[model samples]
Target: MDRLKTLMDWFDVRLGVREILRSNLQGYLLPRHVNIWYSLGAVLLALFTLQFLSGILLLVYYLPAADKAFVSVERIMNAVPYGWLIRTLHMVGSNIIVAVLLLHLLSVLFMGAYKKPRELTWLSGFGLFNLSLILCLTGYLLPWSQLSFWATTVATDAAGAVPWIGEGLVTFLRGSPSVGAGTLGRFFALHVVAFPLLFLGLVGFHLFCVRRAGISVPPFGPSARPAGVGTTFQHEVHRDGIPFFPNYTVKELAVVMFVLAGLVAITVFAPALFLPPDALEPADPFTTPDHIKPEWYFLWAYQTLKIFPSKLMGLAAQGGAMTLLALLPFLDRGEERRPFHRPLFLTLYGLGILLLLGLSIWGHRS
Candidate 1:
């Protein structure tokens, strides 16, 4: 033990590993009132790590060709050792990460944690969310199954409705007038290469901003500190808050373990339950599925488009909603951070959540 400690001390002296950890994790002061809501960031990181590793493994066997993609997936499932588990985890992790990220966004918004100094943090997070969705869309097409192929067809066709530039966008996305091998290759490149790099860069910046700005204080709790008061808040936390290493890390670890265990249980017991046998079939461009739909994360938007009279109008509305969300930090120019304090904002946000849930359910049924 002494010899091992001596070796570690030697490396730490040379690499400053202990110093980096001290500055970033152990010495960091999180708001005492922060609860499980804050832990969603860690959970997201965990899911992303799983995705990164599983995706690399999947790429080893995946063939990005219209003729071979579906067959390759089958081979991965049946022939490759432990490939089924990795594929299942990747699929399940994609859905769960989106769900958790949405919840985290809502939590941050309701708490008004995006105000003032943390604007960039919110922006970076929003960027990450959108990139994750893009990653999902790109990966969805990788299996080249009926569900994936048809879903990509519908999605790109929708993109082609973007007024004057729509044609070019569709051509660029599909690499042809139709979904074929070119489209598969493009999406595969995006899913495995482009999106991951952007996501990682944004994640690094987001964490840097978080570390620099520190976690937002609870707006309603007794430990709440006023916004715009910088060093004073730090002083209070320094005096009153618990050490993040043992106190908060322990809670975060528990949450991570619980979520991981739940994910593993679901993946093991009913892997790919969400995907039907029809969806697993090879892509057939000639015959469209009777009732084709996107993944559940996009169902709300899909339902909204169905409800609207004009396709262009529906597309614009969806795009406009995302734009509004991205620009929320600048639009919501109030110092108030608590939901209870901002009644009008809270009401609107609540209604938006309700509408989203209602649309998702309607889309699922329709």
Candidate 2:
């Protein structure tokens, strides 16, 4: 009993549950200048938590092998009480989470929140974004459906385009000449164990940085703090800003709760429409699906990949696109944050998105 009490005390101290709840509930702090953009991170966090829980529930029934994988999923949909709902929610939540994270990133970039003291925060977030994308890509293959199978085949084949090591790398990834049972198993392990663990660690670091630094104040505002200059708790919380106790924390909690309730309600009541089951058939090395395409998020890349010439120049185009995505931070080193200030970059971004959407349409048709 004594040891139990000691452990409990340590937990309370580490979480600051008592202090945080007391302060937040009592109205000790409030957000003075936050907007909807500030809510995306919290919303995405809630979505991720839902995805994790639903995914755990799914693992209870999912089979990793080629023969059983599709049947197992069908059983979950038809036999398991709420399995279909959970699976649908998990899929929708994954996509929604990515969308919100992108919104948060764009908002932060435009707001100039990436300026000085918060660069690490932004960097950690960038890492989180990349990790989330990987999580999505890996998870997509777990269902082992026809769509997932061909999608992986097409994607891995693209990776093989990497210069000297392309063919060898592709061979290693597929574990054979094509997408087979081995590929499914490898992707399943990565989706379930590897990516989630990395994401969990990165999430901890991301939240810690957010709490320690607090949200970035908007530039050119009355409440704006100078770059590299963070105020003391006394000044920021008690004197100048809200205490973060009752005020801001309460709002954050309210937002989280509302999002969770909404997501769960939707999942339970109205699941997203899934593709036909025929699409889940084991991938055949000989025949390709008529509409061979990627998930919506990667439509742009797939389209870009399609446009590349079969010759050396095609390899260069594909390689350069991948490198650009990987090294965006380094490529655009300008300090200016406002969209108006970076007109050229903004124009390029718009044009790129447009081209991606167009290509996705064209690829889907072809």
RMSD of each: 2.1, 4.6
C-alpha TM-scores of all predictions: 0.95, 0.80
State each candidate's clash count: 0, 7
Worst 10 residues of 2 by lDDT: 230-239
Sequence-dependent TM-score of model 2: 0.80
In model 1, the worst 10-residue window by lDDT is: 230-239
Query: Candidate 1 versus the native: TM-score?
Result: 0.95
lDDT of 1 at 94: 91
Q: Which candidate leads the pack in TM-score?
A: 1
Error of 1 at 277 (Å): 2.8
- Native-vs-model 1 lDDT? 0.87
lDDT of 2 by residue, 1-366 (tens): 999878878988889676765654454443467666777787887788888899999999999888888888878878999887888888878876776777787777667666555556777788888888888887877777777888788788876767788889888888887888888888888888998898888888887777666555554455444434434431224335565655665677787777677667766675643354435575565677776667667776666666767534555775576557545656666555555667887787678667766977876666
